[model samples]
Target: MNKLAWVLVSISFVVGSSAHAQKEIPKAEGYDQCPLGYINTLGTKCVSPIYYEVEPTYGEACESGWMNIGAGYCKKKTILGIF
Candidate 1:
Protein backbone atom coordinates (compact mmCIF):
# COMPACT_ATOMS: atom_id res chain seq x y z
CA MET A 1 0.00 0.00 0.00
CA ASN A 2 1.06 3.60 -0.42
CA LYS A 3 0.81 4.22 3.32
CA LEU A 4 3.19 1.35 4.01
CA ALA A 5 5.67 2.68 1.50
CA TRP A 6 5.49 6.15 3.04
CA VAL A 7 6.09 4.74 6.51
CA LEU A 8 9.12 2.82 5.32
CA VAL A 9 10.52 5.89 3.63
CA SER A 10 10.02 7.98 6.74
CA ILE A 11 11.75 5.44 8.91
CA SER A 12 14.65 5.18 6.50
CA PHE A 13 15.02 8.93 6.35
CA VAL A 14 15.11 9.23 10.12
CA VAL A 15 17.67 6.46 10.47
CA GLY A 16 19.86 7.88 7.74
CA SER A 17 19.78 11.41 9.19
CA SER A 18 20.62 10.17 12.67
CA ALA A 19 23.53 8.14 11.40
CA HIS A 20 24.90 11.10 9.46
CA ALA A 21 24.55 13.49 12.39
CA GLN A 22 27.58 12.35 14.32
CA LYS A 23 30.75 10.82 12.96
CA GLU A 24 33.01 9.17 15.51
CA ILE A 25 36.30 10.95 15.99
CA PRO A 26 39.26 8.77 16.76
CA LYS A 27 40.82 9.08 20.21
CA ALA A 28 44.27 10.62 20.37
CA GLU A 29 47.20 9.46 22.50
CA GLY A 30 47.64 13.00 23.82
CA TYR A 31 45.37 16.00 24.58
CA ASP A 32 46.58 18.40 21.92
CA GLN A 33 45.09 17.25 18.65
CA CYS A 34 41.36 16.52 18.56
CA PRO A 35 39.43 15.98 15.33
CA LEU A 36 36.94 18.55 14.15
CA GLY A 37 33.84 19.15 16.33
CA TYR A 38 35.45 17.74 19.51
CA ILE A 39 37.03 19.43 22.48
CA ASN A 40 40.29 18.33 24.11
CA THR A 41 40.04 18.00 27.88
CA LEU A 42 42.75 18.06 30.48
CA GLY A 43 42.70 14.26 30.84
CA THR A 44 43.29 13.83 27.11
CA LYS A 45 39.69 12.84 26.61
CA CYS A 46 37.57 14.42 23.90
CA VAL A 47 34.16 15.68 24.85
CA SER A 48 31.06 15.86 22.67
CA PRO A 49 30.36 18.48 20.01
CA ILE A 50 27.45 19.82 22.08
CA TYR A 51 29.92 21.06 24.71
CA TYR A 52 32.08 22.84 22.15
CA GLU A 53 30.04 26.03 22.13
CA VAL A 54 31.83 29.37 22.28
CA GLU A 55 30.38 32.15 24.44
CA PRO A 56 31.53 35.49 25.83
CA THR A 57 33.41 35.26 29.16
CA TYR A 58 33.47 38.98 29.97
CA GLY A 59 36.43 38.49 32.36
CA GLU A 60 34.64 35.83 34.41
CA ALA A 61 36.33 32.60 35.43
CA CYS A 62 35.12 29.04 35.21
CA GLU A 63 33.95 27.21 38.32
CA SER A 64 36.04 24.75 40.27
CA GLY A 65 36.78 21.46 38.54
CA TRP A 66 35.48 22.93 35.25
CA MET A 67 37.80 23.98 32.47
CA ASN A 68 37.28 27.22 30.60
CA ILE A 69 36.78 26.15 27.00
CA GLY A 70 37.45 29.55 25.53
CA ALA A 71 34.83 32.33 25.28
CA GLY A 72 32.54 31.84 28.35
CA TYR A 73 31.65 28.14 28.19
CA CYS A 74 33.06 25.86 30.87
CA LYS A 75 33.18 22.12 30.43
CA LYS A 76 33.45 19.67 33.29
CA LYS A 77 36.76 17.87 33.48
CA THR A 78 37.00 14.11 33.62
CA ILE A 79 38.12 12.85 37.03
CA LEU A 80 40.17 9.67 37.10
CA GLY A 81 39.57 7.29 39.96
CA ILE A 82 42.44 6.03 42.05
CA PHE A 83 40.88 2.61 42.20
Candidate 2:
Protein backbone atom coordinates (compact mmCIF):
# COMPACT_ATOMS: atom_id res chain seq x y z
CA MET A 1 0.00 0.00 0.00
CA ASN A 2 2.04 2.98 -1.20
CA LYS A 3 1.11 5.06 1.84
CA LEU A 4 -2.50 3.99 1.24
CA ALA A 5 -2.34 5.29 -2.32
CA TRP A 6 -1.06 8.66 -1.30
CA VAL A 7 -3.70 8.77 1.44
CA LEU A 8 -6.47 8.14 -1.05
CA VAL A 9 -5.28 10.82 -3.42
CA SER A 10 -4.95 13.28 -0.58
CA ILE A 11 -8.42 12.51 0.66
CA SER A 12 -10.02 12.94 -2.71
CA PHE A 13 -8.19 16.16 -3.34
CA VAL A 14 -9.37 17.51 -0.01
CA VAL A 15 -12.94 16.47 -0.57
CA GLY A 16 -13.03 17.81 -4.11
CA SER A 17 -11.54 21.14 -3.20
CA SER A 18 -13.93 21.57 -0.31
CA ALA A 19 -16.88 20.90 -2.56
CA HIS A 20 -15.71 23.53 -5.02
CA ALA A 21 -15.15 26.05 -2.29
CA GLN A 22 -18.75 26.04 -1.15
CA LYS A 23 -20.15 28.79 -3.36
CA GLU A 24 -23.86 29.40 -3.79
CA ILE A 25 -24.83 33.04 -3.69
CA PRO A 26 -26.29 33.96 -7.03
CA LYS A 27 -29.93 35.05 -7.24
CA ALA A 28 -30.02 38.78 -7.39
CA GLU A 29 -32.77 40.75 -9.19
CA GLY A 30 -34.34 42.98 -6.66
CA TYR A 31 -33.42 40.38 -4.01
CA ASP A 32 -36.86 40.76 -2.49
CA GLN A 33 -36.39 44.52 -2.64
CA CYS A 34 -34.47 44.64 0.65
CA PRO A 35 -35.04 47.92 2.46
CA LEU A 36 -36.55 48.66 5.85
CA GLY A 37 -34.18 46.97 8.32
CA TYR A 38 -32.58 45.14 5.34
CA ILE A 39 -32.35 41.30 5.18
CA ASN A 40 -32.01 39.02 2.16
CA THR A 41 -30.33 35.97 3.76
CA LEU A 42 -28.08 35.01 0.82
CA GLY A 43 -30.50 35.44 -2.05
CA THR A 44 -27.76 37.79 -3.15
CA LYS A 45 -26.55 39.35 0.10
CA CYS A 46 -28.32 42.33 1.73
CA VAL A 47 -28.54 41.58 5.46
CA SER A 48 -27.05 44.70 7.13
CA PRO A 49 -29.33 47.11 8.98
CA ILE A 50 -30.56 46.20 12.44
CA TYR A 51 -30.52 49.40 14.41
CA TYR A 52 -32.32 49.44 17.75
CA GLU A 53 -32.04 53.03 19.02
CA VAL A 54 -30.82 56.55 18.31
CA GLU A 55 -32.25 58.07 15.19
CA PRO A 56 -33.41 61.45 16.24
CA THR A 57 -32.56 64.43 14.07
CA TYR A 58 -32.91 68.21 14.18
CA GLY A 59 -30.37 69.22 16.85
CA GLU A 60 -30.56 65.78 18.54
CA ALA A 61 -30.42 65.84 22.36
CA CYS A 62 -32.32 63.05 24.13
CA GLU A 63 -32.21 62.81 27.93
CA SER A 64 -35.21 63.92 29.94
CA GLY A 65 -37.39 60.84 29.28
CA TRP A 66 -35.10 59.49 26.55
CA MET A 67 -36.30 59.09 22.95
CA ASN A 68 -34.16 58.43 19.87
CA ILE A 69 -34.22 54.68 19.13
CA GLY A 70 -32.82 54.05 15.68
CA ALA A 71 -29.26 52.80 16.29
CA GLY A 72 -27.32 55.14 18.55
CA TYR A 73 -28.96 54.40 21.92
CA CYS A 74 -31.75 56.18 23.85
CA LYS A 75 -34.56 53.97 25.02
CA LYS A 76 -36.64 54.87 28.09
CA LYS A 77 -39.57 56.64 26.42
CA THR A 78 -42.12 55.45 28.92
CA ILE A 79 -41.84 53.24 31.99
CA LEU A 80 -42.64 55.59 34.80
CA GLY A 81 -39.34 57.24 33.98
CA ILE A 82 -36.86 57.23 36.92
CA PHE A 83 -33.34 56.42 35.72
User: lDDT per prediction?
Assistant: 0.47, 0.42
Would you estimate the TM-scores of all the predictions? Answer: 0.30, 0.23
8-69: candidate 2 lDDT, tens digit per residue: 99889656544422122222343344333434474554443432222223345667766643
> How displaced is residue 2 in candidate 2, in Å?
5.9
What are the candidates' C-alpha RMSDs?
A: 11.6, 18.7
Candidate no. 2 TM-score: 0.23
**Largest TM-score belongs to which candidate?**
1
Error of 1 at 53 (Å): 20
- lDDT for each residue of candidate 1 in 1-83, tens digit (9 for 90 to 100): 99999999988965654553333333443325544446656454455544322222345786665566542344444433110
